[model samples]
Target: MDVKEGDVLNYDIVVVGGGPAGSTAARFAAKEGADVLVLEKRQEIGSPVRCAEGVSLSWLEELEIDNIDSSTSRTMKGAILYSPAGNKLKITERLAGDEVGVVLERDRFDKDMARLAVKEGADFMVKTSAVGLIKEDGVVKGVEARYLGKKFEVRADLVIGADGFESQVGRWAGIYDSLKPKDIMTCFQYRLTGVNMDPDFTHFYMGSSAPGGYVWAFPKDENTANVGLGLQFSRLKGEKTPKDYLDEFIENHDDYKDGEAVDMVAGAVAVTHPPEKAIAPGIILVGDASRVVDSMTGGGIVNSLKQGKIAGEFAAEAVREGKFDEEFLQKYEKRWRDELENKLWRNYMAKETAMQLDDITFDKIIDALSNIELETVTIGAILEGVKKKYPELVEEFQNMI
Candidate 1:
């Protein structure tokens, strides 16, 4: 929808992005009969995608989002983790953690999600960006946005920030802090065709190849994959970019050395724990704006979806009760925390521990896991297995156990 210049719009809730989180929030809120609007800065809903485009099927079922077959690129059976020395530990879908179930065509997936929101009566405007917050007496009232070179105001009882890593909405509302260099991961990816790899499994490579992060190959089909790597900003040396590291990795691997990149994407992702506060008066922050990415794996889709659903439900409640104060909005914060905070905190700590390991230790850990036939795969389970075979290797992770 297009708004005229100098237009002043009003809604029960205004969402500051049209990605998965924002769209999901808008859909659920609109489903509950609240007036909602989503403003997307991009001309297209999911053009120039920045995500790794992987999600766990389990969570999709939890959210009851079943109409995704057309958006799915590949259904994965598991993931294979490779140590620096090339030692491999393969985990099946049931135990492969959050990112291995399906590879999505993100552009399509995002559009489909927005379609769901539209179907539920949420209005959306592409090329519209939230440039600032509309605040009254120190409380956020809505957003100051720009669409096709025209500035406008959107007044709402509630505002949700689902803007990605470089989110300004959260900062505009004073609910976010600047991410430290160590807590940011610079990432690069290529949609490569003619790559030779297992189509059923997502593959990961660990150690200096990625430097404090890891490299991944999420297969989109039998002969194509999205190959990418992330580097912890603090670990970067002079003049070496994420693209440089990824190119080096691809050149060194036979499976990808001869492949052609049909598309490329570059971006940065927050690798920090959730913020101490994600809500201010009449405002709530979701997804990357709230730093909810999994520090261990750099995954956010599931967590973002989870948070969006909770935010939407609470926003609807706020609309019904006609209350949008910070205290009233704290219910959203409490519920998301109860459902996701503990796991996020644990993953952050695990990431810290993993970053401290040398290549030899990584090889040892992977070897231990390979030797054990675990009934389930989890950080604690992996740690326990390592403790039995290589006690000293898991010493730093004792607290997590």
Candidate 2:
């Protein structure tokens, strides 16, 4: 099974991208007896990381991922959400497991995930970019790719597209891959040291500074944090970019003003309505490539990782049964949707409603939420409380609850 340069290789399953989702899919598929191979466009598995590196502990536990301590930076207990006028609403882990997740050493986390996939008998190729699909009679058969400037073909019975938000695989397969500007969040983040803040809580600022989105301050350690902001591109009314807003925010905040900036990153996150289909004959999309990110939270690592496991398991099953058509691959869509699509859709609608709220409405929400115990809070309960004070607004959100 050695893959030499300029030689055509074959695998039972070929996963494009070596991110968490790709690695997870490769691992599970290989474990189920498929000859799997992963192609990462980058020279290294996890270089130039583009994430905030935060994830929920409960889901990680559910995934049964081991050796997590190697990549864990800090464990959070809860979150503190601030209104436009700065009113605070605190929520503990008891009510929100994701709010109390851990900050990760993202590079290490990715590398470890890929390593695990290799241990499960999956082959990996870095500096390998999948340029196009290998199709026969209108069905995907594999990928046309390049490695270290040499082009080659990889034939596989199944293809898993974990190539991220701007997924070429999804596009090449004739699936709808374009996202409206309103559905995309332009973000800028700075990893800073010497910032003094509580390491146990993640801070969120909701207001016009980042219209239709929020600013986040996630602690990596006691004196270091990832300070960033994400704003819906459609709501960007003027010339100022997310970077400008973030700089202004840091200047106004006492704790972050003097912090030493260690690194900076910029990217766009797809928060659009989920596609009607993430699968086609002989292929399936996973992770950001599938746009599984929660619109409200702008987070997808957990969902993406979970879907990777689902897709991998199903791919192996399909290969074993000699079924690789859309009808069979559709089951992969069904299983993941059953597990996460409902919640993702709900959150997307909720985010739409929240984005339209005025500053006053947010303040009212914070006030109402303050009156309730965090442990007893749910979407319905919070909306019910809001009804007592703002019936019209609550009515509009009733469907969301």
Candidate 3:
């Protein structure tokens, strides 16, 4: 539906898609005094969350962003790593980053952020889907969308697209929206309600069993955890899906065979770093919408919060200064990319090399790693071991190294 002139829907910064990225962006923008509005494509804002629910508290602090709520967390003590041969090694949550992250009730957490955003004076339209951008003089000037089948247009001085992976905003803004099949990770998780877990450390199982990917059991409520699996699409070429792998995993494992099944969640994540360009003439993209997820660990909440805040702050500041071009918006890219992109670059490189290892090689590598202290087990550490022990293998990734 075309938007008529003088439409009532308008905003200083219209934020499309109110997930963590959108909410945080809206909250910060409104907190900074922008007339912000967030449109979520669902009825219940955070319901049916499609995330792994793990986030680094340490990283959270660095962003200095508030959790949408305090009531919806399942604090975990740490994480565990399992080799292809079924050998398990655990690191206290403290070890990963020292008091690092927590498993959140994602739905509640989302609503909380929405509450904060609303309290700060941001409007919300649930069941809204952004369809296209309205351009003027070759610049993004507004968004046209559908809310409960009713067409509406929102004009904004700045439009922040936090719509996550599969975002039309990026395509509308002229970004190449295609993520290489290898660049994305397909994930499947189940919120098992009657299962027994370590109750402390998250468990990650790796090797050919989950080629190009791994399996995880992240702590949630007692007797509950987000048990899931993720694998590169290439891995799925001749194998079962992540969900199927997860089922086989649980069924074969003696301790998990009888666990009652409850909620199941599934989604795809951009395991790549943020795209080369995240902002355009009159808009900026954040969170999964910009592929801000970490390729190394598949973690994104902290990164999303950080990116969203920057987009929010810049949007408001840009509005105030009347600058909305690439020159002004590029700050969003430089800030996030400079601080975090290089790490992702390294991760992407390491991931490609790591996935090629067979179970025996995985065992050898892990056994070698066992000799090194966890504190020193950086990507460089692993690469060095591969170089010293498997010189030929390192040769394959020498360019990346």
Best by TM-score: 1
List the lowest-lDDT window of 10 residues for candidate 2. Answer: 370-379
Who wins the lDDT comparison? 1
Model 1: weakest 10-residue lDDT segment is 92-101
Looking at model 2, residue 54 earns an lDDT score of 74
Candidate 3 residue lDDT tens string, 28-123? 888889999888888888888888888767655554555424844676677777887766666664456654567888888888778878888889
State how far residue 107 of model 2 sits from its true place (Å): 1.1
Global CA lDDT computed for model 3: 0.77
Model 2's TM-score against the true structure: 0.96
RMSD after CA superposition, every candidate: 1.4, 1.7, 3.1
Cα error, residue 366 of model 1, in Å, equals: 1.2
Order by lDDT, highest first: 1, 2, 3
Please, what are the lDDT tens digits per residue for candidate 1 over residues 1-401?
A: 67788899999999999999999999989999999999999999989899788777768776768758989999999989899888999898666655458999999999998998999999999999899888888877889999989999999979999998888888877786688888899999999999998989989999989998999999999999999999899998878899999999999999999999999999999999879999988888888888899999899988988898898888999999999887898899899999999999999988887887888988998999988986677788899998989998888889887
Instruction: Indicate whether candidate 1 or candidate 2 has the larger TM-score.
Output: 1
Candidate 2 has an lDDT of: 0.87
Candidate 2 residue-wise lDDT, 321-354, digit = tens:
9899988888998999999898888888888888
lDDT of 1 at 309: 89
